[model samples]
Target: MKKNTEKTVNIWDRLRQSDGQSAVPTDQPWPKIWQGAEGLGQDFEPDVEAGLKRLKAKIHAMPVAGARIRRLTPLARWTRTLAAAVVAGLLGWGIYLLVQPATPVATWAEITTQAGEQKAVVLPDGSKIALNSASSLTYRTDMNEAAERQVQLIGEAYFEVERRPAQPFKITTRQAEVEVLGTSFNVRARAEETTTEVEVTQGKVAVHHLIRDEKVVLAAKEAVLVANDQPLVQETSPHLNRQAWRTGRITFRETPLEAALPLLEHYYNVTITWQKSAAPACSITGNWQNDSLTEVLQAIAAYTGITVKQLTADTYQLSGICK
Candidate 1:
């Protein structure tokens, strides 16, 4: 069973309380932090590039639109936070194994993307995966070279799966199972959501409902929304824009408001609502790249003669296009 959110939050709190304050003075060189990190892990070599990337992630997670920023009060606290967070992750899971004996667990590799972050990963078999914000993909250590490739996914990601004739690649989510020899597809399986979404960009995949004994095959440009414990069904994708997040460009080819709005929602991590009759006769076509939510809304509103209004950081309303 999954742990509760409060429990996870408490862990972060305890980690902060573990008293890992850095003692080095400001005059101390980068080598000191490097040495401290090295002491934490024997095999760790401080990679400047990788460290910068982590710093970038911390900044990126902060909202760009006048969002509040929480600063670590002291320099030592910042260092301690980083150190404790890493150590807690490495030690927390294994600590229980000492008290109770259990079967050996298979080694797994996990890649995670934080909110507002995107990651591109290459598997051992040359398969590629693009993880969207707030998602994780986990696979066995021997996944690529093994007889069968199996993976677990949570949140959203796009896969450019490698073809291994003897080995079948399968992805398991909370709501559905997907199998393919080689295909490019996107999956959205948010933990709190009852519906699992799959969109195929190339080749085909077989999707099997986890709770129900239902199955369907989806071809390129096809998609499906499998509700929790419900039947599996294939349907045409409302738009060919599912993988657009990876490219940072959402393409709309005469896409209707109903279809186009969801893509914008995904890209901006926002909620949008409009009247049922809003822009009923309007179809949109354009490519939006690295644009803010407000900017994109204005462009769409201008094109469709709709009025776009921002209600909150993550909410919007649309009107005036359908009349």
Candidate 2:
């Protein structure tokens, strides 16, 4: 017992003198040291196999000698944790964006006019549209929030667009699109007609053919026709009679009777028939404003020496020969 006590005391003394260095010599017997430590657990029976396994596990867990151990400060550990959290949040956000559905477009507000009926409307943007007979116009209700003010048109209509440089006004038809900034223009895109016409009465406008991808720019009193799959045709001097329905004015310059009759019929919403086998070769040259159909017919009879007779409330007939 005295010999064992002396051996344990010498081991402890050598460990204290070695400071942080490995105190046990390579040639020292490990069993002797283990036997001394077994007394620490006095009530437990120390199994040799279990004790060897535990010691081997501890040896594997220990860091290698002479290796530098860098200890992280509290702030560094917190920064690493925060960086990991941010990366995870960004990954989740990207997945959410990929799975979401697209937003839908806004609905349109529509206005229409029946046969021989004319209607006038003031848009939300303070622009004015005068719809002719058998016409339809549509615009988005949320036009103010949109980047551009856009309207779709069918049949004929006159537009007086309000000036907003940041938001341009656009008119879309079946075959053509017209864009402008503060302008007065007329668009004729009747369903029965194969050609669409755009006439600018004030300011300027750009016309594009939807199918052929042709484009033209027009100033005041200029016009363009977008025919089916054809190149754009621009006119420098558009006729004044194009807006006669709105202005209540009609003018004819050396226009044949056959050609002039259709204009009058459309303007008055009436039908005219010729009693003779063929229409007279006489041409008409006159201007009438706010004139009744009968009054205008009388002037035509005086000018061409033809007999004008009313067949019905909305019908007229020409019988006599041209002078």
**Model 1, position 70: C-alpha lDDT score:** 83
Which pairs, if any, clash in model 1? Answer: none
lDDT of 2 by residue, 126-171 (tens): 9999999888999987778889999999989999999999999999
Q: Which candidate should be chosen as best, given TM-score against the real structure?
A: 2
Backbone clash numbers for all candidates listed: 0, 0
RMSD of candidate 2 to the truth, in angstroms, is: 11.9
| Model 1 ranges off by over 4 Å | 1-105, 251-262, 271-290, 309-323
Error of 1 at 293 (Å): 2.6
Encode model 1's per-residue lDDT on 241-286: one tens digit a residue. 6667776777878788898887787777789999967567778878
How many angstroms is residue 47 displaced in model 2 relative to the true structure, after the best TM-score fit? 15
lDDT of 2: 0.87
CA deviation > 4 Å runs, candidate 2: 1-104, 275-277
Q: Which pairs, if any, clash in model 2?
A: none
Cα TM-score per model: 0.57, 0.71
